[model samples]
Target: MSRTRIVVVGDVLLDRDVEGTVDRVTPDAPAPVLDVTGVHASPGGAGLAALLAAGDGADVTLVAPIANDPDGRLLTEQVEVAAQVVPLGHAGRTRTKMRVRSGGHTLVRLDDGGPGTPTTVPGDVVAELVDAADVVLVSDYGGGVTRDAELRARLTPVAGRVVWDPHPRGAPPVPGVRLATPNVAEARAALEAHGRHADGCGGPAGPERVAARLRSAWGCAALAVTAGAAGAYLADGGQVRFAPTPGRADGDPCGAGDRFAVSAALALARGAGAAEAVEQAVVDATGWVRAGGTAALHHRPGPGTPRPPGRAGESLEALAARLRARGGRLVATGGCFDLLHAGHVAMLQTARTLGGSLVVLLNSDASVRALKGPDRPVQHAADRARVLRALGCVDEVVVFDGPDPAAALARLRPDVWVKGGDYDTSALPERFVVEGHGGSVVLLPYVPGQSTTAILARSATGPRPDLEVLR
Candidate 1:
């Protein structure tokens, strides 16, 4: 399928996360001393929204101002990976946010640079991009890029779906936008700013009232108020729908709204209705948060180190603690994985897409012997782990010394427990354990004629086997 073309216009900035460890208190001051471990950086604001849309398989174009500075150069390099960036001229330094974190907790955040008056891009250039786009997203982060009345006017008559992510410090969107997404706080503030009294906007009738007020005030076709863990409340054409988030993955919600905006815009470009687009956006945003949210920009601790990033073999307690701290979604599946066939590869790949990280709980040599009988398990536990680690879809490989992964699940408390399609949820023994921790069980489709037992039987009977049959 051809990708949806999305044009994003708004503010762009650079975000940096400095991760370190905190030990003893400083002798000179009362503050704790931090020993820096690693630093990571990514594009933020509208740049993030554009990158997110591009990541979701859209052809995204970002038009925003970047100061001629080191930060601007860095931002350009990062954003260009996922979008075609059109930089506008500005006189001030590029906006940058630096966060200092220790042991998965943010200690302090320092903001550098300030918003400057953005030089207006030519109207013809702006109009040409908008004209060709399937969706147009305005990510106003209280920056002046969207403040130009002429630029806003140029976008007003575009024939594509328009999604507006508003910031209080920035100008309001022009009329005729298809959708407006704002968090609860931003929604309340926006209503008051427009002289609209949303007296019952925060009550049971909150979504309905707020949506009505905002849709009318901004002349938008629909409005969705993101209520964090409560999900998003959407109102369109006088009908209100509540799209509950799949589950909560706690992390810094800095770019969550931006993710929501781009997801919804892409959905609209794909011909989904406003309510359906909002629903999909909620699901995408939930996944984004589970995958470490803004923390993904920083270094994560791996195995065999005090702080290592990505998935490496570690104790269940340690992995669970780190995932919980980062609000990550852990997707776990277990099996003997004796031969590592095509079926196994496909299952692991599908499981990884369901959440942030995929943990492969491999059976120990003894456990595999018990399950597969004495003659099974052509590869050892360490060899199996090594092969699983080689696959990009597999994140962490943990060898469990039991027939079932109940003990490991108890320790890890994964958000999703995955299995093959051959197994039914009702027949699974660990269903209760997974659900008890507010997690769900997923069964992926199993490939036919791709079992180790079948392969072994064929190998024993024939001199050689066809590679196509194995696949």
Candidate 2:
């Protein structure tokens, strides 16, 4: 399947986190002295939204204004690897938000640069990108990107779904936007700005009323008002639905809006309805928060690492604990994968689309020999694992030594267990194990004529060269 093309156009900024430890009181003042330990930098605003979309396996393009400064250069370098970044040069310094933290708690936040006008991308360039998009996300961070009339006009006629994450200082979206996501504070502020009597929180006019009013005001097809801890209230047409969050999320709420917007946009790009998209976004955002929110961003390893961000080979118990803390869907599939083929790729990619992460359980050499006879497993377990790690669809790979994956399933406790359509639930020995953990088993479509057995058979009929496979 072709990847979904997403275009994110809005404000971009740089975020820096300075972490340290408070050791003693300062001699100059009575404040505690912080011994600096580490510093981390990442993209914020539309840049982050694009990164999130790209992380979800979408073809993303970010169009935003960046100043010609140190912070701007850093933001550009960081975001360019994640997506196709198109920079519109601005005159002022790029916005930078610095947070000082100690022992996982923020001491103070300092803001530098900002409240400045963002440079507008050329009209033709904006139109060209938006025209080819599967979904357009407008991340208005109270910056001047959305204030450009020409850009807004170009987005008005987009054939794809348009999702607007509104900011009070930013301009409203064009008419006919598909969805609008705003938190309770932003919703109340917007309503009050429009001369409407809106109670910010727990007011006589609840979130349902606030959502309805915002939907009409923005001329959007649907509106979702997010109330932290209380979930979100979605309003479409005359009907309103409340989708409560799974549990209370603990962590910084800074990037929650960006995560929510990108997830919803990706869902829409995949052809999900408005309500379903909003619900999925809520789930993703909730998981993001529970995983330490912005704190998780700093845990990534530096360059030249052997394994990718989520591809490390860990014990089943360790992996399960990490996934639970992360609070997203965990998908697992087991197979020999003796000779990685298109069918295997398709199954893995399909499994990834079913959840936030995909874990592949490979049959160890001993197990494959037991299952497929002595002449099976064209490739060794190590070689097979190396190849699987190269695929973008696979998040992690584990080799299990058993005829059935019941033991692995019991330890991992994955949320979903996937298999090819060729097999039925009753035929799978691990089906009961998965269901016992409150997980579902999914049978994905199988690609015919794309099996390793057929390839090996054809090879045997042809000239048999040295088949000294690596052990």
Candidate 3:
């Protein structure tokens, strides 16, 4: 499938995260001494949202100005790494947020904001980019970027899908925008600005109220209010629907809402209706949050699911504790991975769906040769390992020394163990190994006719393989 082109424009910022461990109070000032382990510079604000969209295989074009400062240099270096991360102008200093993490929570954050108005380079850049995109995503970080009237006017003539994530600055809406995603606080502010704040609770209180006011005042076609834990609500040209959050044993929720926004736009662009779009986005994003911020983990169900923690689960207690410390899930999936194709993608995403961690177990080159033939698994275990780990969804990969993933899962004992297609759930390989240690297994819905064997036969060397044979 051709990637959907995504053009993200808004306040782009750099997030510098410093991770450390605190031992005890220091004699110097009665403050704790932190032994810093490492520091990472990741994109934040609109830049992060756009980076994630690109990671999901979207053709992304980012148009935003970076300030000509040292922090801007940090953002520039990170952006340059993303080959597709287009920087519009470096005329002004880039917005940078410095967050310090100790133990498990963010202890302190220092933010240095740029002048909240666009410079000459950014203003001219947006006008040029808007003309070339297939869909326009106005990610207003509420920084000074979209404050220009000229930039707002340029967005109106956009001939493609227009999605706006209203910056929390209570800015008035421009005309002809199709969808606006606002959080609870921004929703409340927008309503008050329009003189439409009605007091209520739980039932049509915050976001719904704002949507009603905006749809009437500006003639906006659709609205979605993203509530952190309660999920999001959508109102289109006619009906209104609430997309409920999946009930996962909760974990740290970071960068999850942005995942929802990116998925929502992508799903809608792929022909999913509004309600389906919201639900799918919520499910996927919620799954990511529960996996400890990486978006590849899954956990046991929430407070009210009627079932037990099911079959071959991933994390055992020992491993789960370790993953929590590292801030990701322990994911394990097993397959030939020989001549990798669509079936593999589905399985990898499914394993991720189970929790916040991923570890792929590949059949060793020797093992593949045994299972297929002397000429099979043409790639060595090391080469295969690199290929799988390079996938955006995969975190770490190890080649199974034995024939299958049983030995690998036995040692790693990840929070979840996943298998592809329709193997009998009753005889699932990793069930007893994980469940005996109190972990549960989940059976992801399998996609038929997408096996490796099917793909090879369809290549130019042969006739159209009737995959119906697998059925």
Candidate 4:
């Protein structure tokens, strides 16, 4: 499977998070003195979007103006970790946004480095990148990148392949772009800029109306107006649609928009419909926020630090990305595992030896009931998962509601798909999916005479059952 090519074109900035506690006030003034603890830095604006796209396994190229300054060097160092940088001629100092935070809440934000826009646009280079990209994401951050005439000229011809994330102070999207994503506030402002009243609340259909008007005014094929935790409203093909967030997410929404835009761009690259892309974007954005947003980026496990056991609500995508960054092979196997016996234990232990980590895709209780009879699966899905995760060989346990593990396999995209030797690898439905992603299917020998059904039958008879049978 070749990687999807993504080009992120827009402004790049430095983001600095100063975490501390505000415990004392100065005697001379009422200003609070922060006892600084740590300062974390990363790329902001389109650089962040590029890094996110790369984190999702996309072949990302960042085309942005970066100034030659200390902050610019810092931003470049972070962005280069995940993306290839194509620097445009930049003027002024590197833009930096510093937030003073304490106890998960931000006290103040200081913005510096005014207007780091491109002074010289590389027209041919920009055109070549746009021509080669599967999806071109214009992550306008109200910087002067989007206003560059040469860059706009190159992007205008490839509008159909572009997903524009518009800003309040940025130029409008190129005419006939595939999609334009703007927050509700930006949408309202855009409507007013185009001579419409921005204050009118059109009942429950207000977002829909706003999205439609923006799409028409922007001359884009589709438009989606994001409303933070409330989700997004999309207008496509002369119809209005709403895609609500999967659930109520309560966390910092610092990079939610970047998450939304990048996911939508990737979905489009994967041949999804406009509505499907919007829905997926909303879900991804909500999940990102729920997982602590940008703060979660710095939570990598250090050297000799053991990985915590996988639990419910953990981000499987994030775990996979981290493992992939280490250049390690990922192994996966799925089963009902109704009873954790020697057979299950042996198969899992062997699978772990084939790769750096093993992810067990446990079937949900409902799925087990469908596969087995109604009286089957003595243990529920949660208990089964808990037991599987307790094994030293298992790195993560994911419970799938489907009758088969096809959907789960698609998401994990493991390098090795393992199963019991009782079944033929050629006859496994999962074999096709595994091979489609350049992975191989392996079959480990099943432990003979050690079956869950047999154990259950023996348990119903009496307490005189041999303990050696479980071994």
> Which predicted model would earn the best lDDT?
4
User: Pairs clashing in candidate 1?
Assistant: 300-308, 300-309, 301-308, 302-308
Give the TM-scores of the predictions, in the order they appear.
0.67, 0.66, 0.64, 0.67
lDDT of 1 at 349: 92
The C-alpha local distance difference test score for the whole of candidate 2 amounts to 0.80
The lDDT values for all models are: 0.79, 0.80, 0.65, 0.84
lDDT string for model 3 (291-393, tens) is 5552222132442221111111234443355455666556677767876677688778778866777767788888898888787775787667656755667
- What TM-score number comes out for model 3? 0.64
**Worst window of 10 by summed lDDT in candidate 2:** 304-313
Q: What ordering of candidates by lDDT runs from best to worst?
A: 4, 2, 1, 3
After superposing candidate 2 on the true structure, give the runs of residues whose Cα lies further than 4 Å from its correct spot: 27-30, 200-204, 301-471
Scored against the true structure, residue 440 in model 1 reaches a CA lDDT of 98
**Clash counts for all predictions:** 4, 0, 29, 0
**Model 4 TM-score relative to the real fold:** 0.67
Give me candidate 1's TM-score against the actual structure.
Answer: 0.67
Worst 10 residues of 4 by lDDT: 303-312
Q: Tell me how far the alpha carbon of residue 147 in candidate 4 is from the true structure, in angstroms, after superposition.
A: 0.6
Candidate 3 local distance difference test against the native: 0.65
Of candidates 3 and 2, the better by lDDT: 2
